[model samples]
Target: MVARIAAPLRRYLDTEAGSAGLLLLATLAALAWANSPWPDSYDRFWHTELSITLDTHTLNLDLKHWVNDGLMVFFFLVVGLEVKRELAMGELTDRRRAAVPLAAALFGLVAPAVLFLAINPSGEAASAWGVVISTDTAFLLGVLALVGSHVPTGLRLFLLTLAVADDIGALTIIALFYTEDLDLVALALAALGIAAMLFLRYLHVWRGPAYFVLAIGVWIAMYESGVHPTLAGVVIAMFTPAYPARREQVEEAERLTRAFRQSPNPEYARAARLSIERSVSLNERMTRLYHPWTSYVIVPIFALANAGVRLDGDTISDASTSPVTIGIVVGLVLGKLLGIWAGAYAAVRCRLGEFAPGITGLGLAAGAALSGIGFTISLFIVDLALDDPQLADEARIGVLAASVLATVLGWGLFRVAQARQGDMPGRPLKLDPPVDPARDHIRGPLDAPLTLVEYGDFECPFCSTATGSVHELQDRLGDRLRYVFRHLPLDVHPHAPLAAEASEAAAAQGKFWEMYDRLYERQDQLTERDLIVHAYELGLDVERFARELVESRYAPVVRDHVISAEASGVGGTPTFFVNGVRHVGPFDAETLAARLLETAPAA
Candidate 1:
């Protein structure tokens, strides 16, 4: 269910946002070091030569190049890993859910380039348009956190999905437009390295060392081929497999852990460790291992190296009048804002996609404005696109200025939105269309003192587990608890809507709970024919059930529950509301029972 996915994603966002403070300090330090009395030290220190040598061969670069071309590869690798994971099983897995953001990302890229080019027209500066095509994910999320709890979770998710698509666009531009004078032989060698990586994946080689060596080979080849070596990170990540933890693998891990608990042997411990590791995909494992290092260390180091532009009165004056600087400011600030908003608007209007529930127009515009904080990749592309020192400085200045202005603009818009919507912090989300015995499927006494409502999907594995927990609570609480089930079939579960409709069809025959149990008990067998089989097995009027399902007579009833769930802020399956208030955290039998007792009327 989405709740499982949201846990990891929330952790990722938190880590990235937490690192923003360190990144800010690093940027300020860079500016200070560049403008200090010992200004030349900043340049001299970063430019000091460093190299590795072998017999008749040397790999040489200055310290700055090492940070940019070397350490930053891990940063790109993390980005690539996130993109792959999203495409595999995260937000981007759903076409309808992803369409709006993906379309906005497309325009987010195109509009910035067009605006940059329109201002610079034709010159070396025109090539620097890549500078405005990205949003700094860390800064974007950090600023969003500043907007307080009034910001809906859906809006945060929308922006994160948009950022993923935006990252893909920037990576493609770097690999295609920025490279020059390709050494065909080295490029061919890089191709071979990529092929070898694919072969390893095909061979089911999960060893990190093997892939690490191949990644190094590909990075070196890419460097020699004049294609930005950081791209090798992306290439390696593409071949890295990502999948959810398999149930069988998890069961195997549990078995091994139990054996280890009994025997306490070295072999058992090692086996248990390997079992747990194999249960999770390599891409997720590596992302967890590498993301922190990249966010807190490599990215800030890159910032410190790249953001140290020597700001002086003359430099500021020149940048103020410079067309390149003006273009970058307008491109990132105005272009991203207008482009993202317009693209999202068009997608909804043209019926290509819809925004998440609870995302208002003003919130969308605020998110669009925040997309203009193009700091990290902007500075990165500035290095690749401009050879002139003054030009690069102007670009960096523009990037900094745009980021600050965008943050202010976003904050102001969010303030206006919160005021208009009256969504104050700590507002309790209560169940809408509160449970009614007449209109709901109830399994306990109508006048029970405690009420538990579940907005769940038949096909959700988590909901199936929650079903067991609910049965336990029913056994313990008896007639004191009134349990109600509502339909909220998710789009990812292809069979879930029909399954809900089938349950509704049975409900009309006065056997709703019977059909619910049968469906969850045989989830894999929920095809159209399978639903008919279930209806016949339940001893319902077979022809009548078939006719209702064929006509989709109960679809509106299921849809009404979905609408109510969304209005009540139920984003995922098996969401529980106890005594009319939404429950947070674990949904085990003991947890729910304890919560029910706490909320029960005093004796």
Candidate 2:
């Protein structure tokens, strides 16, 4: 799921923080190696000739080429998959979801590109726009993790979604702007290979090897086709099934659970046990197998192989004075911030889009500043854009400057926002149905997988589903999930009144979730007496509970939650703010899980 491959090529990269750490060390080592007295070794190492061929044809390239052309093909495949899936169901699934990030990414990408181009002009080395606008997730987060406590979960999620959307834009530019001439015969083979991959998926072929084999075919086909072979990874991705599982099918899975409570299929039992022995993997195995590959291998290889540059005795002005380097540095560090901030404000002020909660216009600008961490993809793109030796050199320097500056500035802004958080007053409200008494106020300094602010209605079935889904994520993530619930009673729901009252009564009784359970279990039962009975059943301090409800002790707290929901642009009930992303309906357990992993906290 993490892999952007249109067909889900990232299972290998997901679920492996240890591996990510190793990859980070490797990249740092490469940079250190390149800049050390052994700099010649760095240059020589990548330039080492590597020749490989089929029966009649051969390709001769450096070790770097193999990394980019060979391994990166799979990386691109995952990237391709992510783009396709998002278009189908994620942030870009619909026009509504696509509005904010897409617009932001457009500016994020374009302004920097213009800055790079304007400064560099048409020199032999001036054509590298690819490096100036990228934002590297791994390096960015690695840096952010250093300043752990200060980052609000909301701001982090906002940054993550922006990065995902920015990636799509970056890839598109590469495919459209950077490719070489096409060879018709090879192009035909690649097309035919892609068609076959789609056919296989359509045939319900779940085998990973089959996908891999066909993907290789596509890779080879594209390589010969003379289009940038990497894009073959992107194009074929459009055909991968986004909704790999239908809603009905997912629901069927739930119902089958109870049916199999006392009975286990012998064949399934053996398969399940085997899967667990390896690591309790499940039926939806595509992402599990490939996400890690894309995240770990593809990204790290790209970074290690590309992030090598020498700065011994070099001055900041060495790059700052050069047109290409200056352009890239200023564009990413300055242009990205300007464009993103302006674009977001324009859209929100015009009411074309609204700012997410815990976010002010200024806060959005701060996040945009952070988006300047264009490390991984930036370096990757630089190779494509600055084919000339001189411009490429400039690109390396500029990206380094911009990335560091952006990180520091962005972090500072976020800190300012947090320091002044109490100064910016907001209102939240509670709804019918309460929280579990055993679970309220469950927060700790160590808990940071994500901070979830759920604004839901008890009368809504989806909220009922969300309750279970949140619990499931909590169990899987342990103390990582920090949840704050708010009531946003939709006018359309009829049974909402009693539900709110019950939750309020539960808050009075110090058993919020217990009252919540009763309200949801019997959404159709919402009389005041019904609420009172649930309170007594919870063994509440009956007289004190009644008095608190009368005084509306929980009113202001609940109001803050509701206002926060409104700030996030929730048009309906059952909306949620996960790390600051306003995810609405059509959310399922897997989707939430994938997003959580995608927005996994730094470090």
| TM-scores of all predicted structures | 0.76, 0.67
Question: How accurate locally is residue 588 in candidate 1, as Cα lDDT from 0 to 100?
Answer: 100
- Which residue window of length 10 is worst by lDDT in model 2? 1-10
Off by over 4 Å in 2: 1-24, 143-154, 247-285, 314-317, 422-603
TM-score, model 1 to reference: 0.76
Worst 10 residues of 1 by lDDT: 1-10
Off by over 4 Å in 1: 1-5, 202-204, 423-603
Q: Write the per-residue lDDT of candidate 1 for residues 236-319, one digit (tens) a residue.
A: 888788876665687799999999999999999989998989888888888899999998999999999999988899999999
For all candidates in order, the CA lDDT equals 0.88, 0.65
For every model in order, what is the number of clashing pairs?
0, 45
